[model samples]
Target chain A: MNCIPIMINGLPGNVARIMATSALRDERFSFVPFSLTGEEITQGEVSVDQTTVTLLKPSEREDKINDILGSYPGFICIDYTHPTAVNDNAKFYVAHKIPFVMGTTGGDRQDLERTVKNGSVPAVIAPNMAKQIVGLQAMLEYGANTFPGLFKGFSLQVTESHQQGKADTSGTAKALVACFNQLGTDFEISNIEKIRDPEIQKENLGVPEEYISGHGWHTYTLKAPDGSALFELKHNINGRQIYVSGTFDAVIFLKSKIDTNDFEQKLFTMIDVLTAGK
Target chain B: MNCIPIMINGLPGNVARIMATSALRDERFSFVPFSLTGEEITQGEVSVDQTTVTLLKPSEREDKINDILGSYPGFICIDYTHPTAVNDNAKFYVAHKIPFVMGTTGGDRQDLERTVKNGSVPAVIAPNMAKQIVGLQAMLEYGANTFPGLFKGFSLQVTESHQQGKADTSGTAKALVACFNQLGTDFEISNIEKIRDPEIQKENLGVPEEYISGHGWHTYTLKAPDGSALFELKHNINGRQIYVSGTFDAVIFLKSKIDTNDFEQKLFTMIDVLTAGK
Candidate 1:
């Protein structure tokens, strides 16, 4: 099997660094020795093991990308950039006919989908990369489709706890809320209880002290009107390993689709990856 | 309407006291002016506003119950006693033909149900009396009956935080686990994470200072096999108000059932009360 050459964006970000480390360890993938860094990053390069990856800021990417692509033709791009940069980065990839995997969330999601659909390049875009979580989501979607209004009269309460630096409610929690809504709940995305205080994470949420800076715990509760019955669901993630594994799987899946010339399915999601085997 | 006389047992216990206070404030029922106390109680009575309820120890209850029953014919009994006293207390109520509410959990639940089913007198039995939670359980039962194995490939993690004085896993959490099992997750009762240490409860579980002595926070998490999807449900109760209100509702429901000569349905649960109107 030929090694898949890939460029990992969002270097210096923790998630991006983790993904890059994982890809380096995998025998199937080879890094292109280039990364797209935030404009604020003063460092020209980032070190990974013994190899140093050259970092390109937005101002320098336009001039540098042509040379990088010329050196590693048909190479795939992996994005782990900020939510604000999702759309602009996708437009850049599409403008260059460079197929990519968008591992970042936020930015106008609808526009992200439209960019991939209308453009020549196909991409794998998902808010979440964990296969187990995506499989659960597929099941939820199944429930929503097969049993809509199943929890119509049930009252839902969503609570999520992450590292203190996370400024917003978990996008995964918000997506699950949408599934709940389709299953007959009237919950608003904004109603999610975001627990970002380290004290609360330790004292109230029962998060381990070591994982205080890198974990995600979410819970959704449904109660009856009379307060007699309750149905609860929850997920606790201790680290970024799950995301790393799933990101690799997405890369492999997207590569297979590209190899098969399946450009018609230009826009794909984690759900597609989850159900691909089935 | 005739005021139904009720004798709330377990005097000095916080839960029973809260129920007594609620009952005293409601005009629909009248107190029997008596309570059954544990043998350890040194006090002869407990005060509630202007009314003083005479406390009867285990030694006194056998003799006192006869006289009290003769005084207030067909009076209802509300038991909020120790787990050890559950079966014996039920035996006492059953032998005397005095219908009762078994609010306390633990101690051979199947035997308790059998006792109610075989006895001539009727009773309301439930592990949890919180109306909203009971209603949610009803919905869970509906889903379980309607969609068994709904979460087959899902992995479940149950975590519950309670007061340090609580020696066992929450009965409510255990009950919800049964629901999840029926819905397709293979989780054992012993697998539930019971949070008891005050430091852990305060630091990791986020129980409030005021409620550390009397709170129950339960979280149930389900994740797909590949870690791609997750669904969570949670319930955080600060105090016993929910249980108190639901206890009162159960009493009212039981009284109505007796009034209509519904002796055939002697074994009623919180679900019966929640769905009674529908």
Candidate 2:
């Protein structure tokens, strides 16, 4: 198998580092130079090669791509960049006909899909990339699709907590809210909560981030008339490997779908690729 | 709707009383007399007509059965009888062609199923009967069936605490242990800790039970080869409503699947009844 050489665009993020580690372990892919900023280092960990670092300020991302054009040719850009560069970085990948693997969420999904479509870039984008986690989401999607408005009369309280640096409600939590909304839940992001500490794992709530770390816990509870009955479905994650494994699978999935002759015009998430058939 | 009059056998127990309440509340069914022994009297809280209570000793049961046979010819029996009565109850119900629901657990399951088959009585026998709880069980069943042997290399510590009277591990907890076994875990029930009080909750593990009365929590954590990746799934529940809902659904399901020229012979559990066609 010819190992597809890849370039990771997003630098110095936790997820990017994980993806890099996973890539090094995968036999099907060879490690090329990946980029990251200087500040977002995991304190005291054996740092990556400093020479490979691409220190571009968030504002300087436009010119950053120009510099990369000469350095990485014929390589798929893995965009683990912050949500701020969702468009600018995507545009760069599109203009170059460079297929990309986008694990970065928390951007304008509609605009991003439109960018991928118009740019004609073969890219993989997903809100969440863990197979088991995505599998749960897929089940929720089926419930939302097959049984529209299944949550009728049932009250919903969506709670998700991530690490301390995470400012607000998780994008995945919001994505689930969208899925639940399709199931007829009149829920708003304001109705959801993001906790940094372990003070409140209450009547019906998610455990706090400090208690849950590197862990992703989301719970959807449906209660019945008079508070007499309850139905709860909860998923708890404790590390990033599930996400890394899912992201690697996403790359492999995109590799299979790329048309060497023509720029692909379809916008597909990892779920589509991971579960392409059967 | 013609309310089907039913007889609740051995109705003095707490669980039997729960069934009685369900039977009284259910619009399709009407309670017709009850037989309870000893002095379980709860005054006005459980009043259904003292005259209707048929008090009987264990030795007088055969004579009482003759009297019941003379009066009621085709009434369904909801047998929440003791384990010792399992065989005899099945014989009586089957010989009279009386359809029944058996919520009593802990007897010889093989013998009970055999007796029900030989007697040709359409019966719904289950260890649990709460409807919505069965829905929760259905989710686990779905997870197991869809992703067989998925969570390998996962360290499972299932700490469940029921009421003080709930000696030994819970039946539901044992069932969850079986679920883990299905996923290739070789965990033994005797090895797991069983907490009874708030200190036991705080000592063995840091969990506090003051907040989790009659609570049952199961947590499974999957770690990576380097201990860097972890996935944890924890389901915590408090109270007996799940059991109530599960039992109710089981009754409704059994009633719908009688030998009345409708459905074929199908062995159903909470999983089948809760997901119902899914």
Candidate that would win on lDDT: 1
Compared with the true structure, what per-residue lDDT tens digits does model 1 show for residues B192-254?
998888899888876778888888888877776855446676777777877877777788888
**Candidate 2 per-residue lDDT over residues A86-152, each given as its tens digit:** 8767776777677888877767888888888887667888767776566556555655554455444
Root-mean-square deviation of candidate 2: 7.4
> How large is the i-RMS for each model, in angstroms?
7.7, 5.2
CA lDDT, every prediction?
0.81, 0.61
Report the lDDT tens digits of candidate 1 across residue range A1-278: 78898889999888899888988988999888999887899999999877799999889999999999999998899999998889989999999988898889889999998999999878889888876566555556655654566556779998999888889778878878998897788999989999989999999877889889998888888775655445676777877878887777778878888899877979988766655543
* Chain B TM-score against the true chain B, each candidate: 0.86, 0.75
The superposed Cα distance between candidate 2 and the true structure at residue B108, in angstroms, equals 4.0
TM-score list, all predictions:
0.53, 0.67
